[model samples]
Target chain A: MEQTAQSKSRYGMVIDLDRCTGCGVCMVACAVENNVAPAEQKATERTGVTWLRVYPVSNGEGFPANDTVFIPMTCQQCGNHTPCVSVCPQNAVEVDPSTGIVGQIPQRCLGCRYCMTACPYHARYFDWWDPQWPEGTEVLLNPDVAPRMRGVAEKCNFCHGRLHAARTKAAAAGRKEIAAGDYVPACVESCPSRAIVFGDLADETNEVSRLSHSINTFQFLPKLGTAPKIFYHSAKEWVRKMADRAPLA
Target chain B: MRCKGLILMLSGVLASLAIGWFAFPAALYRTEAQPMQFNHAVHTGEQNGMTCDMCHEFTENGSFKGIPTIAKCTECHSAAIGSTESEKVLVEQFVTPHKEIPWKVYSRQPDNAYFPHAAHVKRAEIKCEECHGPHGSSSTLPVYQVNRISGYSRDIWGRNISGLPSHPWEGMKMDRCVRCHAERHRDDSCLDCHK
Candidate 1:
């Protein structure tokens, strides 16, 4: 009954890279769900406020050996020592204790980009300008999430807005525990191939939690000891190698 | 000759003082009279004996009602109550037309701020007068002053150049809030208040 906002569940994702077809549906769904505005000018990978980015990774070998794996990248929601949470001069970025989801408060952020620089995955993206939704498309923007203002770093927080709604509904319903189906991130829901799996990794019985312990599953930059919550599964060895690359400073 | 030099120096000093105290603040804040003058004392005083919550009641969902609609005033003053000019103006100008009173709230927070009144007023049980001073007992209305640079009320920074509030609840700056939160051992995370 006293679970306020500070619960201790390791809410995370287990994505199957083999199922992902580089269609970029997750990126589009994330943008709409979060009300991520369009760039005034043409946007490059470095510039746009894309919370979930899909990068097509390839092997160096030519012809028959050449194969691609589209890796959907997001904030790994590191547990052990969150780099962004520590480097933030203002306590804007935080690992929410209850859900264990890394949350960012844009209102507190000073746009110093210290968190962005500290993040090895390059998951954090700075809002260069105020988010400007295309004409009349604002109705399409999800009312659950707040549209972020300019001059702050933003990344995937596993759709905290949805989590909030679920919590509220649970409280109103007089249920102490939130049902797992009530909370799902936009990217996970939007995937046509069911590539993404999201659930409470803390709950040993949960499907995502069990799948995270699979032999094929691997996490990015495990050696740095960030202990990122998000895991990836792939049958291909090249895809696993690409994912397990040494942490880039 | 000494007297002449002293007079020149004294005039220069006085001119600088006037510019510093008057001209600078005047330039910073643009003063504007309110559309309607509200006498809080008449409603809150012993005669009518209306509480602040009577007019500024919270919604069922706990959202602050802020300035009440003209319909709330018209509930009592459907016709002119007494022969008071202000009451007549209230009926003719607003109640008759059914136009809402555009009250420029003194303690209005910035867009980024997320001070939920329900948490403070309902849960914490802090009196409105604690933050708002004796505004309910006052007959006179304060002139609204908007800062040119930050677009905030002069009341937000308090009426001092040093930003030190005369009263405990005078300033609405972040420091003042943090200091109080620290004293109470409340959650002072930026997200706690800044949303």
Candidate 2:
């Protein structure tokens, strides 16, 4: 695969909403893999941490015609002037130039909710309480991912821990490029329908990149010019129209 | 009245400072002793010809084995070879009972901190002594001080009361790690070190 310095790829994911079953496997997998803290007893959807949440939106019709589409949403990994990265007063969030991954430094985050306000996608979740995995589940936690504390704002980091693991393996193998199969995100890996495809969009050979260029593909809030790396593919015209809603002034 | 108000404010400041700098630190860390006084110089020094990895080894999958297990010590100290009290304790107390030596690690990072020794030691080629200091050549293990507030060892934040690190490896605060990463021109992605 002609992997070179000039070809440092922009990582992206093209998720097929058409194939999605509205199942919460990706959500559970993301929470489990990332050690996302549990919600408080009186927690709401607004406060709970879901790194990759499946948002089920309706077609806005009566019972006969009404249909739901499950869109898996995450950090969006915006490229040009990333909102969360720019708005973070503490410099806690950063878009890594090498991987095109938007990383949140929980240790550095002051839990001001500035990044949470900045993100239009609502991917960022603040830990309302200290992370305590259910009983013995703590031992089963993926050791590669460190659990964030209560006051830290956390989001989908695209399973950067797994990426680092793959990189380490590649470095040991004396290979410069991480094989695409070796670096799938928790959400993408967990999806039963293989609805989510993650890879370097800059690389033409990568399947996700190819899928991204398809006419059916669309990004959320494209008019905002955030230029998110995630692309969603849906055959339904309403879903395509629903993807690029204008950001509120 | 103004002078009295000033005195009150001054006393308040003094009390806070005392709590932060003196009383808190005194109350913060609880002193604990290691099961055995380990002489690193004896094992890793030239005469014995033993290596750090020979005892504190990595798992087959490259995860660090934090402390050397009792079996490792039994391999060499099957009987009390050295005529020292600590060696006698190691042999009789732990080795005889086949108990694990609770060697309280001075530089053990918190659960939130995910440090990959292989990435640092093998990939970056950083010497163990660089981060661990002269621990390998030290005669005895230092006192284990556990912070009451954060439940972290004082060595994690460094033994310095002022938070001003005297040596390169003294403190392991996030900034120190960032400083080192910046020096190496490595990607300081939070997950890169934190996980």
Candidate 3:
């Protein structure tokens, strides 16, 4: 379905870099929630599919002076001039106008990797091998999220299976909108430090919206004008500067 | 000789059309009988007056229960209510054995497609007959035909080999869904329906 109308709710996130411990709990939660199979024996860092990845950046100081900051990155969910959506020849990448969330349809993907290359954040991952789970572990996979087959590109869609469930619950209760706490992503819920603040950025009263506009909150590669919904907040000058620069480098 | 050649070419074209329309569908679909024949008319008849939702209900969380289990059937058919052979078989084979009936769903979609029955039935007030035709009024369950290659029901592709719908309720293809959603002016994204 083509969503031509402007969305009322723009779902976004504000991640506090200072609070993130880089424990990789969010990554584990994301994998389990989305039914992302564990990496095959032959898969490497480059080949493995990780919806969320943590990178530790250093202060570039000697010994005791050196400090590290962990940055958790996923799909930025570009609002304007979305690079992946434009480059997808199969029309697999889409920006959901209702919730303002970017979605990837793996069934429609032709494994072209055009969307992967178009994404400046390197968020999209191509499936190098067929999905495999440890024996007796297949039954533990989340039934809501369908396991994607090989030869397709996949990435974070903010735990859309949970969103679907939330919507279903709302519909059952004779409501149109889902409750605020009904649709939290796996990463945000699993965060021990509560570093991630997620909500409708369009809603002025929302904490995520407030944090997005707050001082020191920045988006990666803002100059490119992709208008990413995911925002990063940090008090340090170098951390903010590093976020403003190309995230890949 | 030119006239003979033209006739021969026309014959070839006609043969191809006949094979494409008639023979292809037969070769493509494999028909299998349902485990048991269910008479919906009897259940929804004047005596019983049971509605579709009475059996095929939505859970409290709004997930659709596509088919009722043996428990639901046993509530009525604990011991053959009628002298029908099907009822006797249901009691002895399934209900008595406490085994779930292996019912083949006709409107079963792929895992990627997320169809919310609650949104359609409860919110929009769309009758079950809108998509399922008159299954509630049916005297007997129809044979389930599955495509050999795609493993999808023949109902999804519709009865027509040309991909044309003979009835308004025919075919549950993406285009059919899009057409309905477009008519309703309900704008949706890929994630809304496809998980």
Candidate 4:
């Protein structure tokens, strides 16, 4: 592999808050695709590995509450700099050059869980037990990846496996780059509402990049310099206001 | 008189070299004879046609399968493979009573090292043999031993300085990671190697 340093992969996402119903399809798909172990069934705080979490925001009306909004959360893969990437001791986490994908290598990780603490979104998770599957469920295991072990830490890899698989197929066919249609993160593929868009930001023709500059588009904590690749889009003024910090009273 | 002195000098050097060779290996070799001689080659061999994933299963969620339970063993051994002495033991200890074998793991990561086999195997298209050698070639039963102090296998730290296992049985260690990382121009920050 000729090492291409920052080959303008321009990884980015656009979440259409207008269409989101807070259904949580992205969360379920993320867990299943990434092999996030079930920790607790009752409260999300306990069991499930919700990679793309949905947050409910109130419209701030009193008893006759006007409206509510759903915001799906995930590793923003902040560009320019990410807090978790800098705080990580083992370099287990990285922002890959080709895909702008954030990579987490489990074998290289020591489960210190520092990255988890650094993120305000709480995207990272720690493995509490050795992964177990219900009997007869072994056949359902994905043959492409390693199951995580107990006493380790884990988080989203942005479905980098799928991207690599796509790239590999492209390369095998004597192509130098991945087709836009050939790759998508599991959440993006499984979203029922079509609220999520994945694409290369550097490609001016890309839909995601175009929507990123839309009047409704916004990034979380942009002032912090995280440069999150995931962008939220909403037509509601209050919802868009909530996407960034609230104006000082 | 000079000849005698030379002979004494040569003898002293030879004695020191011998001590260094034996003492170093003796101190380093943490192999404790395992309770069983489980040969991966026989189990994974084509004659048996055993797939590595059969025992090391992974879930769609990307979690790796662990040591099978007694029921998993009874899935096949319930009928019994009385062809050899090892088979007899397998039947008696695990099959008859439905007891799980206390197989020692030789390739466990540290408490902090997060290794998910599914990501590499299913998503990365890595083969089992890439990390574990040809386990199907051995006919003997496997034995797992741990370091008494660290409660881990010696291979976790790697014996050879070069990071390549001097023997196929040698497990992956931190040294192996550092060596590979250095070659690939990957991260080697303490954070990268430690966690």
Name the regions of candidate 4 deviating beyond 4 angstroms: A1-6, A41-48, A62-64, A246-249, B1-195
Comparing chain B with the reference, what is the TM-score for each candidate? 0.88, 0.87, 0.97, 0.73
Report the Cα lDDT for residue A125, model 2.
Answer: 90
Evaluated at residue A10, the lDDT of candidate 3 is 91
Worst 10 residues of 1 chain A by lDDT: A1-10
How big is the positional error of residue B185 in model 3, measured in Å on the Cα after superposition? 0.6
| Cα lDDT of model 4 by residue, A53-102, tens digit | 88888877888766999998888887877778888797778876656667
Better model by TM-score, 1 or 4? Answer: 1
lDDT of 2 by residue, B7-125 (tens): 99999999999899988788878998877788999888889978778887766444567678899989989999869999899899999999988777788787667676666665566
* TM-score of each prediction: 0.75, 0.87, 0.96, 0.61
Residue range with the least summed lDDT across 10 consecutive positions in model 2 chain B: B186-195
Residue A142, model 3: Cα distance from true site in angstroms: 1.9
Clashing pairs for predicted structure model 1, backbone only: A6-A98, A7-A97, A7-A98, A8-A98
Residue-wise lDDT of candidate 3 within B1-195, one digit each (tens)? 999999999999999999988998999999988888889999999989999999998898899888998899989888899788888889989999999999888999998898988877777778899999988999999879999999999999987888888888989999888888888787778888898
Q: TM-score (0 to 1) for chain A, all models?
A: 0.94, 0.93, 0.95, 0.90
Model 4 / residue A223 / CA error / Å:
1.5
For all candidates, state DockQ relative to the true structure.
0.11, 0.25, 0.53, 0.06
Better TM-score candidate (1, 3): 3
Pairs with backbone N, CA or C atoms under 3 Å apart (clashes), candidate 2: none
Top candidate, metric DockQ: 3
